[model samples]
Target: MRIQFMLNGSSETVDAEADTRLINVLRERYHLIGTHASCYSGECGSCIVLINGEIFHSCMTPLFRVRGMRVTTIEGFAKQHAYKEVLAGFREAGLSPCRFCAAGRILTTHALLEISPNPGEEEIAEYYRAVKCRCTDFRTYLKAVQYTGRLRRNRHRVS
Candidate 1:
């Protein structure tokens, strides 16, 4: 099956099987390896990607489901200015997740900040619960998200 969709803000088409997972299409066809697959069953948020501006586990999403939809992987999200702010926040907070969970954590951070530019601590903790990063403590990651939110809010205030 030929699937067409807007990938990373660009129109993209690839031949894929109906049963093929979107993760495979991304990593194999497009070489978007930033969308990792840890628990292929979606139990882990490692394969999460933005589908039409929301997070979805690409490992569980079928290629056909993304037809004509907009998909954004960490590679794509990293190109945005918000990514720079998030990176700065991480650095300021001295928080760095392991390579395994970095992409998904960053994507989740982007989603959370996009939805609520000034999310409360509880909101940050609530969102971080889904992203399991064993290497780093939840407090560190939560702090990073909160810091990023603050940076974004400050940027908006200045604008």
Candidate 2:
């Protein structure tokens, strides 16, 4: 199958099996290793990517499903200014997620912030529940999300 989609802000065209996992095409074909491959079954959020600005597990998403859609991987997202805010928020909250789950955590934070720039505690918890992090505690994750929201709001105000 020939899948064409907007990757990170660029148009991409690749011939792959319709059943091929989006994660494999990203890591192998595009060398975008930031979208980690684990628990190929969508149970692990490690392979999370933004499909048209919404979170989706690349491992479970077939290449064909992304055709004509927009996909944003961590590598592409890291290039944007929002990624810097997320990193700063993590730093401010002293929340260092294990490398195994960093991509999922960061991407999830971006998605959440986009939906609610200043989300409440319960909202933060609900959104973050999708990403499983064994290294950091829930409180730290909450702090990070809150801090990121603050940073985003501040940026918006300044602009």
Candidate 3:
């Protein structure tokens, strides 16, 4: 099957089995190593990627599912300005997630902030729960999300 999708900011096409997981195509074909493969069951958010700006587990997602859609992996997201804001928030909140869960944490933060620029405590808690990580406590995650929102809001105000 020939799947076509917008990857990062460029259009991409690859030939592979329709059932082949998106993660394999990303890592093997595109050489996008940022989207890590952990639990193939999709329980672990390590394989999360943004499809049309929404989070999806690449490991469980079939190549056909993303055809004609916009797929943004961690490497892709890292190129955008939002990545800097998220990183700054992490630094401000002293929340340095280990490499294993960094992509999930960053992408989750981006998705949450995009949905609700000023998300509440419950909303923050709800979203962060999806990414399983022991590198930081719940309170720190809350702070990071809050800080990221604040930075984004401020950036928009100045623009």
Candidate 4:
């Protein structure tokens, strides 16, 4: 099948089998290694991606399901060049031990923040729970939420 969609920010075409998984096409066919697939079972959240503004684990998602949907991977965020603050927060806190999980978490958190400007601790915890990082620790994740919150709060300060 010839798949056509917007990738990162550009329109592109991909030739893939009808039943091929999105992550496989992305990582193998397209060579977009930024979209890492860890569990390949859609439970790890390592292969999570934003497809047309909603989140989905690309590992189990089929290419046909995303034929016309816009795809956003870690590479897109890196290219758009807007992941500085949150990324730095995770970095300063040394959250890079499991780099595969970092990008998905940050992307998910960023997307959630877009909808809820000031997400409470409970909300953050709930969202973080859906993503199973290696550590299973919420302390650092909460700290990351706080860190991103500070940046968001400061950005819209009314003075």
Candidate 2 similarity to native, TM-score: 0.97
Model 2 segments more than 4 A misplaced:
none
- Candidate 4 per-residue lDDT over residues 1-159, each given as its tens digit: 898988888898888787889998888867888678888888878888889876789998988888888999887877653477677656665565367676678777777777776788898887786578776478787777677767777867944
Model 4 local distance difference test score: 0.77
Q: How far is candidate 4 from the true structure (C-alpha RMSD, Å)?
A: 2.3
Q: List the candidates ranked by lDDT, beginning with the highest.
A: 3, 2, 1, 4
- Stronger candidate by TM-score (1 vs 3): 3
Q: Candidate 4 — worst ten consecutive residues by lDDT sum?
A: 88-97
lDDT of each: 0.86, 0.92, 0.92, 0.77
RMSD from true fold, candidate 3: 0.8
For TM-score, the strongest prediction is: 3
Arranged by TM-score, best first:
3, 2, 1, 4
Compared with the true structure, model 1 gives a TM-score of 0.94
- Answer with 3 or 4, whichever has the higher TM-score: 3
Model 1: lDDT equals 0.86
- Return the TM-score for each candidate structure: 0.94, 0.97, 0.97, 0.86
Which ten-residue region of model 3 has the weakest summed lDDT?
A: 127-136
What tens digits encode model 1's per-residue C-alpha lDDT throughout 35-98? Answer: 8878898777889899998888899999999999999999998899988998988888788877
Best-matching candidate per lDDT: 3
lDDT for 85 in candidate 2 is 99
